[model samples]
Target: MTIGKRLFNYALIYKKTIIFALLMLMVAVAADLAGPFIAKRMIDQHILGIDSYPWYETDEGENAVLYQDTWYKREDHFSVDDVKGKEVRVLQVGRDYVFVDQPVTTPEGERTYEDGTLTITRSNEEMSYPAVELTNDELLSFYMPEVDDLFKLILVYFALLVVASIFTYGQKFFLETSANRIIKKMRNDVFTHIQKLPIKYFDSLPAGKIVSRITNDTETIKELFVTVLATFVTSIIYITGIYIALFLLDVKLALICLVLVPILVVWIKFYRKYASKYNHIIRSRLSDINAMINESIQGMTIIQAFRRKSETKEEFEEINKDYFDNQNKLLRLNSLTSHNLVGVLRNIAFVALIWYFGGQSLTANSAISLGVLYAFVDYLNRLFQPITGLVNQLANLEQALVSSERVFELLDKDGTEVCEDKMPRYKGNVTFDKVSFGYKEGETVLHDISFEAKEGDTIALVGHTGSGKSSVMNLLSRFYDTKEGKILIDGQDINTIPVQMLRQHMAIVLQDPFLFTGTIASNVSLNDPMITREQVEKALQDVGADRLLKNLQNGYDEKVIEKGSTLSTGQRQLISFARALAFDPAVLILDEATANVDTETEKIIQDGLEVLKKGRTTFIIAHRLSTIKNANQILVLDRGRIVEQGNHDDLMQMRGKYYQMYQLQQGKQSSLAG
Candidate 1:
């Protein structure tokens, strides 16, 4: 599915809230659009109604103005049953009201009153009528009948305004609430999906980049939901309301305004053409900057120690500058397209209105009413507001699209499902049959490797760097699946088992132990429900972590910060060892677990290793040959192949690569001692 459709699918999760918000929005728009029509009625029917001719003399007292000695009422105020006496006209000619006893043939012409006579002239034609001028007091009395009705209309308009305000608030509240909820669900899914992704997927991507996708990119998407979505929906509805109002007022002008819809569509297409490119670059650079910052923070010790601070600053500044430049480009595009485009289109609309209305006025009897003209102008002005809003939100729309694409791209990656099903513990019998693998295609990291370890056996793998020692452990742990051959555990192919369930009965302590930010006990137990407090304590005691951790005031409860930076290397390693032992795995793999510690700590860990390996098959990947001398079997790897395999005495008797490596390491120790 397209990114837009994917985003819409997410919105569908909360469709009810969005639908209700849209309904509220429509009501609010309807209420607000009623204002201009009410004003038209007020202006035409009440305020300007006095100029309407042919007042009838009526006997009814109500709405009847006593003019001179006669009771006169405007035709609109005359009741159906009222008795009529004589016809008269009250007309406004050049801001002065005149009382004409008899009606003129036509009221469209210019009028001049002189010497008790009213002369109407149109195109060299003239007619005259006997007239009388009324004072302000008399005119006020004539308008008294409309005062009550006008006040009522004003109240109605105010009530409509109040209704509009209330519904507007409702729409905004619901829309923002839905927006926050959508973003919350999306963030949770992204984080959850990250767990399902394979370790190799993270191998080529930086932690910082992934962090940016989850944090910065998702934040941009939230704005798309919160601000962009609301603005676009509201603006579209408002524009539609305005168009409908315009059509009610004048069809020809409304049809002319239809041109704006196409213009706006084309404008968005053009804007996105450039904006998308800039936004893609901007987002990519932002991820790069995040990655670089993360790497710098992680390696700050080396950076500062080597005095590469200036170089790192320059590198960061370069990426930051690129990001800034692209942002400025997007800003320029928005500035040129948003309000500026709306202003030009608004000017065009007004110019067209002037030309159309001006042409109408040129006809012999063509004249638009004041009320109709006022409402048209009002509706026209209102139309541009939504257009401006929509145009302004285009940048955010494009940005959100780019961010969504990134997020969805991550979500689309193939990931393993975390299975929670229980599998009965099997005997610790592992066998690798002609196994060969590589992280990438056509780049073999491990050659046809075969090995076997029976139950209760200790198998040690010793090799130089880049000699596939850790790769063998990785294959055993199923971090990466091998395509060439099969790995069996307890006579069953490891690939047939679920990764999570397979790992449930296995444990590994890495060369550089990683600890989370928690108490030392929690790190050992990993907050697993199966491992009780007693098991955690026993594991710690068995791993000799108590001896190293006892100096701290909290002892087993001592706080460990990120990556166990607050504790010593030996302390972190002991915690890792305790963690492995706490699980009591059927197969235990220790990958150079003692490579970074001092002799005393290694000796303490050696004792722990003896206990950890009992009655369980163990695979040890060690760089120090002395550490694995007591193993039942030792496999010495060269390149991607195991060159020699035997007991320590047998390897020494064979005088092969293992013997040479062991002699070299022993010679180095002897020289250091001398």
Candidate 2:
């Protein structure tokens, strides 16, 4: 599906609120558009109505003005059933009003009054009528009848304005509320999906890039919903309302203004074409910059130790400069297309209006009223406001679309569903039958790897670097699936079981143990309600963590920062060991778990391992030969294949690869001791 359709589906999640907001917006637009029409009415029928011809002499004094000892009412105020009387005229010649005793032909045309004669000059004809210019008091009497009606129109106009204001507020409130809710749900869904993704999926991706998608990209999409969505919807509605008002006033001129619609549509298409490319680059470079920053922070110690700060800054500047350049390009695009373009179009529209109204319409036989011209100018000005708004929002719209694409791409990845169903813990009898595995196609890292460990057996795997020690542990943990062979736990194929259920009975303590920001006890239990405080204390005690942690003021409650940086390597490893034991897994793997600690700490960990190995299958990968001397079975590996298989005494008797490795390690220890 297209990004727009996906975005629309998200909006459907809160359709009711959005629909109500739109309804309010429509009402607000209607109320606001009505102003021009109301002003036109006031201008044509009341303000300038005093110059309308055919005043009738009336005996009724209700709406009649007493002028020159005669009570005369404008033709608009006379009742249909009233008796007919001799016709009289009231005309505006220049700034003065002239009263004619007899009506003149052709009320519209250029008018002049001199020597008690009023002349109406048409294109080729002139007609004259005897006339008298009315004094200020007479003109005031003529306008007195419209005073109360004028005040009423003013009140109505303000009432419409108040209604518009209320509805506008309602629309904005509901629209923004719905927008916030949509973004909240989107962020939640994205974060949840990240949990279900396979561990291998993250092997090639940087943590910073993923963080950018969750935070920076999603923030851009929120602006789409909040600012871009509101602006586009409001601009379109206002433009439509203005067009309708224009057509109602004059169809010919309205059709001329209609030309702007296609022009704007074409302009938007042109803007987006270039804007999309620039925005995509900008967003990608931004992600790169974020990734670099996160990497630098993570490895700051190494960087400072190597004195590579200048080189690191230069590398960061390279990516930052690319991001800055793309931003400048987008800024230039916006400058060219937004208000500057709108100003040019507005000027063109006014030029057309002048040509149509001033050059032709005003001098024609059926000239438009001054009120129509005023309303047209007002509507024309109002029309460009929405256009300018829409143009200004184009950059945001493009940016939002790009960010949405990135977010949606992540959501579209195939992920395993988290199964919440519980299963009975299996007996820790594991078998890897002729397993051949590789991270990529046709590049096997483990070849024909076959092994079995019955329940409560301790199997040790010792190998040099790149000999697939960790790969074996990873396969056993189900972090990656084997394509070439079957991995079984208690005679059941692991592929058939849900991933979450398969790992429920297994745990690992890595060489570099990870700890979250919480108390040492909390990290031990991992906040699992099933792991009681007693269990946490027992697990810590079993793993010898309590002895070391008890020195702290808070004991088990002592705080741990990120990665447990404030704690010693031994403390962190002990906590990791406690965490693994607290879960009470049926199968446990320790991958170089004691390699980084001192001899004393290693001895404490070895004592804890004896307690942790009871009633559970254990696999140990260690380079230290002495660490695995008592294992039930040992597999010595080289170049992704097992070279020798036996216990330490048996392998030493063979005098093969395992024996050679042990002798070499013993020589190194003796030399270091000397």
Candidate 3:
């Protein structure tokens, strides 16, 4: 789906809240709109006293009159039954007729006059007289109650202002809350989806770039919901409402203001086109900068050791400069199209209004009244304020769209292969049937490979670097699918098993074991509720890791710093071995697990491995041949194919590649000893 449509879906989930917010916004807009109307009424009727408009006063009979496309109440004369204390508004006055606020009511079957004049006769009709015209001063005499009610008018106006403020605040609060909720969900969904992506996806992307998508991009989207969205909605309403008021006041002036609509549309269309493009570049560059920074921080020690700190710094400076340059481009665009440009448009509108009205007065010897002119200017200013606001929000809107596009791009990619819902547990019998694979397409690294490990057998893989030992391990775990042939667990296709279920029953102790920042017990059990404390203690004890734990201040509860940096290589390996034992996986893969430890530490790990491998099929990928000398079977791989396979003694008798590698390693050991 398009980013726009996807964003709409998020909004739809909170439709009720959004609807309520919009309604509140409208209520606030209505209250705000009332301000100019009230000002106009005070100026025209109270201050200028423009005309005398007649109104009816009667209590008993129904009265109705039609004037100027409106209907009002009219009576021939005042009656004793007339309501005693109600003040009537005089809406308009002319030589022939008058308009009023009172509603006109006619008897059901009476023949009524269409014009202002009306006559009625009855058995007990009261005294009556013809409708009379009143002067502005005479009308003011009837408007004495308004003068007395001035304080009440001011209070009501202020009350409406308060209502507007309250509703506006409510609208803001709800919109911000909704935005936060959406951003929270987006962050969670992105992070969860990241876990489900294929392993190869991570190989192609940096951790920081991925993190940027989850954190920075979603943060940018927040403005869409909170500020940009609110501004767009409220500004549209304000613009439309202002135009409506303008039309009601004077169609000619209103029509003149209509020119701005097309201009604004064109401006936005042109601006967004370039803005989105620049913003996309800006976001991508930012991701690059984040990736560089993350890599620099993580590998600071390596860079310093290699004496390449200056080169790394230079490379980072280049990336940072690229980001800064792109940002300046965006800044320039914003400078051109936003507030400053909007100010020019606003001033142009004011100049146009003045020019048009001034021309009318000069050419026709007539002009709109000062009060009407003032109200027009007020409404016009209100109309432009929102337009200016929209212009100012353009940059944020563009940034949001760019960020959303990147976020959705990640979400749209294909996830890992699907597996059966109910996968059976393997019984430690693994088989590879002429399997061929690669980390990427068209680059096969493992070809026509076949292997088998019966239950409880320890199979060893010995090979030079890039000879497909780790690749086989990865395929056995189904981290990558076979490009050709098949891998099976207990005679069932490994691909049929869910990755989670397969990995749950398989444990890997890597060459460099990783530990999270938590207690050793927590790391061993990974905080899994299924692994009891007793099981963790026993697992550590069985792996000879209890000695390392006892040395710490808190046995089994000692805090491990990031990546177990505070622990010795052997200690970390022992903890990892303990972790694998705690889970008691049906299959174990040790990838050079003791490669970095001392001979004494290796001996300790070797003893631990004897226990770890009990009743489980094990695959050992080792650089040190002596470590796997007693394996039940050894497979020596070369150029993506196993060239030698047999028991250690059987391979030694053959005097093949494995025999040569073992002799080479012995020479190195003898030389080091000398």
CA shift at 64, candidate 1, in angstroms? Answer: 2.4
Model 3 CA lDDT for position 332: 92
Candidate 1 wrong stretches, greater than 4 Å? none
lDDT of 2 by residue, 324-383 (tens): 999999999998888888898899888888888876555747688888888999999999
Sort by lDDT, best first: 2, 1, 3
Q: Global lDDT for candidate 1?
A: 0.91
lDDT computed for candidate 3: 0.82
Write the number of the candidate with greater lDDT, choosing between 1 and 2.
2
lDDT of 3 by residue, 565-643 (tens): 9999999999999999999989999999999999988888999999999999999998899989889989999989999
Worst-scoring 10-residue span by lDDT in model 1? 360-369
How high is each candidate's TM-score? 0.97, 0.97, 0.85
Runs in model 3 deviating more than 4 A are 50-144, 359-370, 417-424
* TM-score result, candidate 2: 0.97
Selected candidate, larger TM-score, 1 vs 3: 1
